[model samples]
Target chain A: MIEFTMPSLGADMESGTFVEWLVKPGDAVRRGQVVCVIETQKGAVEVEIWDEGVVERLVARPGDELPVGAVMAVLRGAAEPAGRADKPSPPAAERTPRASRPAKPQGGPPTTPAMPAAGRPRISPAARRRAVELGIDPATLVPSQPGAPLQLADVERAAAHPVAASTTRVAPSTSAEARKQAMREAIAAAMSRSNRDIPHYYLGTTLRLDAALDWLEAHNATRPLAERALLAALQLRAVALALRDVPALNGWYSEGAFLQAPDVRIAVATSLRGGGLVTPALRDVDQLSLPDLSGRLRDLLTRARGGQLRSSELSDATITVTNLGELGMESVFGVIYPPQVALVGFGRVVERPWVADGALVVARTVHASLAADHRATDGAVGARFLTRLAEYLEQPETLWKPES
Target chain B: METGKLNPGALRKILFDCIASVAPEADFEALRTDRPWREELEIDSFDFQNILIAVSKRLGIEVPESDYRKLATLDTFVRYLAERMGAAG
Candidate 1:
């Protein structure tokens, strides 16, 4: 039997309130299927099960605040012994909602199927839940093909129409000032630990992106808006590939030692529409092509805003990147997220005075800065990372054309 | 006589609806038509692109990335989109 526990999404997240269970007992779950949702300071994050199995029990009830490592569900895998399938959890007292807080009412999960169709059309279970979440009537949706099961894209298409009244609604409880206050507190706790413990060293430099901007313009000229790559993707790709020469700055500072991360996961600093921010990771970024990376980045931002990020993408970050150029700031120095030793900051790309080939000219340049933990590495190592990053950005052709 | 198709007021409504869809927290009543909304609204480049994408999808008109600067304010945005969607719209 496999015990699925509440994942520690981040240092900022101490616990999460069980929002909904996508699966119930006796349901056969596939590997990588989103099994449930947990509401953290960030938002409603869908938690995925890594192992394929039949759900034997659900230990955590909806509305229960479960701490990190608390068992959420039990599953009997294909290889496991059949007899000991149902491992009963301890009584309600021993479950979540610790002594510090009162046990809230176990309300029905938010996305209850409100439709009562006489002969409902075939719809995927995930799509059904999503339709209800958007306050959409599942019966009104059409499948991709006639007589086929309705998919999430169909619900998305229906929700995208401006005439849908339900699409405009935001949950009062989720968007309330109280939730913002809670999020602010969570950020304060994590940042306080970062400042108190990490001996951070800051560095900055201006990198020219004239070639990059020119190439981007030419590249996007022929393509439609949906497939066009953003400069942010190139910046992230540069940082990820640059880490090859500066692996020292890519991992965590835990237990008084520096451990180089295996994969280059870049946690993007995304600002939520409601209020706060979340730095969710895009895994193995170094291996991805620019187009693939751009698509994934767009999807990540969309999901982050929609309050639908996954749990596995939340916690594990080898490094963080913040781009505040859109806010019109020329430069910004960010505080490093603790355990992760480095944070990269980028100012907006702007037209500025520069000397190229011994002639004065205006060039598009971005102010790139690095904040590193001195304990992990000196300023020189961080400086080298910035140098390599600029090298990648300056040669815009190599960034995309030599795409693996 | 189909004034609604090319009307500035209709264009503005479409634009605001797209913005609201992308950034629900936008205070529409206080939003100024003459201001460069990126800095004012705290919306990043991608979010703004998403807004334009939605607008294009609604009206079935394409706006190139280079033409993004032409839409500095809500007024300019409506005007630019109105130009793309002329009498035939």
Candidate 2:
């Protein structure tokens, strides 16, 4: 039996409310299938199971609040025998509410057969108890809607002799305030942890954007508005390519060691519409073309705002990139999101006087800064990474033809 | 309504409307026509490209990439659009 636990979605996330379970007991689940949805302060994320198995039991029920690393479910691998499955798994105590024990059965081995051979209606523990209180068997209650699970209301309605008024909806304003508080706490914890643990070194450099801007303008002139690439995408590609040459700056520092990530996943810091920020990953960013990168960036921004991000996108970032240019800031030095060792920041592109080939000239420039974990790398390594990043930006044509 | 012969005020309104859509917080009336959009309005390249799209869509004229330099300022954009409309007509 494999234990499927609630994953730590990010450094800040400590606990989440179990919103819904997409699968029930006895269902054969494949690897990478979304098994449940958990609501966090950041948003609702569809959590996936990493192993193929038949769900033996759901340790935690919907609406239960669970801390990070709490076991959410138990699954029996396909190769496991069904005979020993009768042995009950331990109840998830952490998910239980403080005021009262849930109506669901807890402790000892499960009484009913876990994987019923016949089709059975899935009902919540509250619904089952309500059915019992009304002297009705829950199994006999047909779901109000086809394929819909029997909820507490269905059981209540069955007992109320068809005259049951719907329960008043809970006020969402309270939960909204609570969510905001939770988010503020989470950010505080994560940032505090980052500051306390990571010995950070800061480095900043200015890059002339003349070549990049020229190439972008020329490239965009030929394409439609939808296909035109954004300078943000170009900057991201340059950073990704630069990471290939300076691998030390492209991974996580954990357990007193630096582990380099296999792929370059750039975590983009996007501000949420509801007054917070989230950094979602753009997976395998080094391989994407400019247009593809732009499209992905757009999609990432949209999804981040809509609160539809996946668990992996939140957790799998190797390094982060934050661009304050849109806000017109000339420079930013960011705090490293722990586990991840480095953060790259971009500032506003502004016209400034420059000397080129012994002649004074006006040039557009952007300030780029790197904040890295000094424990994993020094100023020299970080400087090289920035230098390579500038080189890549200087030759924007190579970004289009990455292979060459 | 000859091709490219749009009224200057109407063209200015169209440009301001386009800018407003891209950067809603921008102060259109206070904008300096001689300054770069980035300097005057803090519009990034993406917003600039979107402005080009809006102009192309409203004016029904293609703003080629080579002519992006001509659309740098409000005055240059207005002149460029007027000239393009006249030439196309």
Candidate 3:
């Protein structure tokens, strides 16, 4: 049986409230299918299952709070025999309820309870807390079987049909506040951790935007509005193509080493309408054409603002690009998001006097800044990446050409 | 000069439709032709470019980057397109 657990969407996420289940018991689930929605600090994210199987049972119910790594459901593998359902597994020792778990000795920090014995139904700590909060006695709830222990789902079921009239429903507004607070805390923790751990190196370059803008204008002139590519899309394409020449800057810094990502997933930093930011990945950006990228970017931005971003988009980004241009900033020196080794920043494009080919000229220019993890890559590599990025932007027409 | 005469009302409708296509959520009825497109419609440079592209495609005229200044408002864009189409004919 494959146990589908609550995934840690980010480093700072500790626990999430089980908002709703999109799948049911005995439902056939394919890999990468969204089986549930969990309300996190960021928002409600549709969680996708990575394993293909027949769902044996859902261990958590709607409104049940669950911690990271807590098992949400169990799925019977496609190869598993259906006859196993009638056959009982070997008996094991009963699990000690959370309230009865032995306390640590004096002067010692309290320790977590020992892992439940094999064959026992696994219950999450958050679930136990939730049961207490709801005034539901876990002991009164029946387990799935004689050998199995009572789980959160059983407690939830009992709470729903309360024998006592004292049970209070958690107010939706209070939960929403809790979610926002959790998101703020998560962002704070992640940013703090990044500052504390990662050794960062910064680089900045001012590139003339005449070539890119000219190409975009010429390209758009020939096409309809729906088919025309945006400047952001073109900039993203340039960055993605530049990563091909300098692959060292396109990956994560993990385990004290730089692990290059297999594909380029450029995470575009999009500001949320609710006063926060999210950098969701545009997968395999190097392979997508300008028009395709433009469409995807528009869709991604719309969904992000509506709080409908998928779980994978949040976690799968290898590098992040923050454009403060729209906000009218001339330049930005950004803090590198941890795990990801590099971040690229773009300031507003403005007209300025330029000295090109020994002649004074007026040209549109944008400041491109890079913040890279020093532990993963040095100044030379970062410089090379920026240089390649500039080259790609200068020769913007080449970006739309078919990849050789 | 045998292509066709530029119709202001027809050109205006086409421009409005193009802008609507780029920004589906925008309230076209409330949009002010005298005000700046960005201020009135909350559109970015890319969106503005798309609007220009739409006008170009429908009229079969090339609106170069240098002519972008003339696309600031509905009046300016309509006049620009009409003059360009007339010149082309």
Candidate 4:
């Protein structure tokens, strides 16, 4: 039996919002098959299976905020005896599976016919819910026969559109209020778990930004307006590259097992839904060009802030970077987002004292606070990662050059 | 589209329009100044952030999602706009 736990996509991603499950109990899955989608604030990403087996059970559901290492699904051998119940049990709190959870006031789960009619089509649980929300009948929607079984679009056309009313509606009501409450509840649950379960050790380092700014100003002078991007991307790219030298920081920790991941997925902490948080990934940042990285970051942040991000965008992260600088926060000691070994927090850039030529000099510097899982990375490893990152940022010229 | 000068009534209408666009079935009449909207409105975190886009479009101002959380109620939300537009002062 192989436990298909929620793999940490990035270092700072302590928790993830379950976006969707690709397979159900009894479905055969091969290694490297994209099995699930998790939404991080950065964007949606499909998670590939590391182990091959038949999905025995799905413990979590869409919209569930699960810790990094929690078992999302259980996989068993094809020939393994089925559990006492072959049918997947619904979530304990709700009788309906996440995919089929009714948006309407239905008291219980929907009943499907024992057998399908010749023309009646099958639909996914998610698409079914979407159909319900849109007041569409899922049974009428044709399931995709070529490849994927069901999707939102399949369900969308099946149902008639709700009565279109003028934009002017009344003020707040129970529906809106209930959604807000649910979101708060989910956030509170995730944060409490992260703070309590994760062992966080914070180290603050102030990096001199004078040289970096000089280099950036010169570089930007020749670039286009759209090319001018957030300073955080440069900081993130540097940190990501530096992680290669300090491999321990680019990994995950679960039970007594410590694992190193070759690819680096950085979660850019983004503010969402007026009050909530989301971390979208900038995949393989080390390989992307400066303009490309900046553009991707802009798009991810726009979707994150705008709430158009799909569920997969929110979850798959291997590391996280939180920038409080935009909020005018001088410094913050971030809670290690779990499973991933480290989180780097960037504080506001301010003029500060620096040592140059054995004398105290005033220079603009940004304070970087790194929080690491004490169980995985030692202080030396964390320090080396930070030092190398700082060096890269200070020498921004290397970032513009094409990699060998 | 001034940075912050929308009338209180205009802002209220805008807020209502925003919610109505997303969840049309949601009852807006029940929302009041002290309704604890986070519980009463069912406005999930995503919806709350999406409102910023609407608010920005209506007011011609870029309202940060993080800043919107501080406005807890419909009345407070309107008041926030009043302040932003310098109308309240």
Q: Output the number of the TM-score-best candidate.
A: 1
What DockQ does every candidate get?
0.68, 0.28, 0.17, 0.05
Off by over 4 Å in 3: A81-180, B1-89
**Model 2 ranges off by over 4 Å:** A24-28, A79-175, A402-404, B1-89
What docking grade does candidate 3 earn? incorrect
Error of 4 at A338 (Å): 1.8
Number of the top-ranking candidate, with DockQ as the measure: 1
10 residues in a row with least lDDT, candidate 2 chain A: A99-108
How close to the true structure is residue A345 of candidate 3, measured as C-alpha lDDT? 94
lDDT, model 2, position A255: 76
lDDT-best of 1 and 3: 1
lDDT of 1 by residue, A38-60 (tens): 77766667887777788988888
Ranking by DockQ: 1, 2, 3, 4
CAPRI band for model 1: medium
What would the per-residue lDDT of candidate 3 be over residues A95-213, giving only the tens digit for each residue? 10000000001111111111211222334444543554564434445555554545666667768777642333333423434445655676777778778988889999999999999
| RMSD in Å for model 4 | 11.4
- On a 0 to 1 DockQ scale, where is model 3? 0.17
Please count the clashing residue pairs in each candidate, in the order shown: 0, 2, 0, 46
Residue pairs in clash, model 2: A221-B65, B4-B85
Angstrom error of the Cα, residue B73, model 1: value is 2.2
In angstroms, the error of model 4 at A67 is: 16
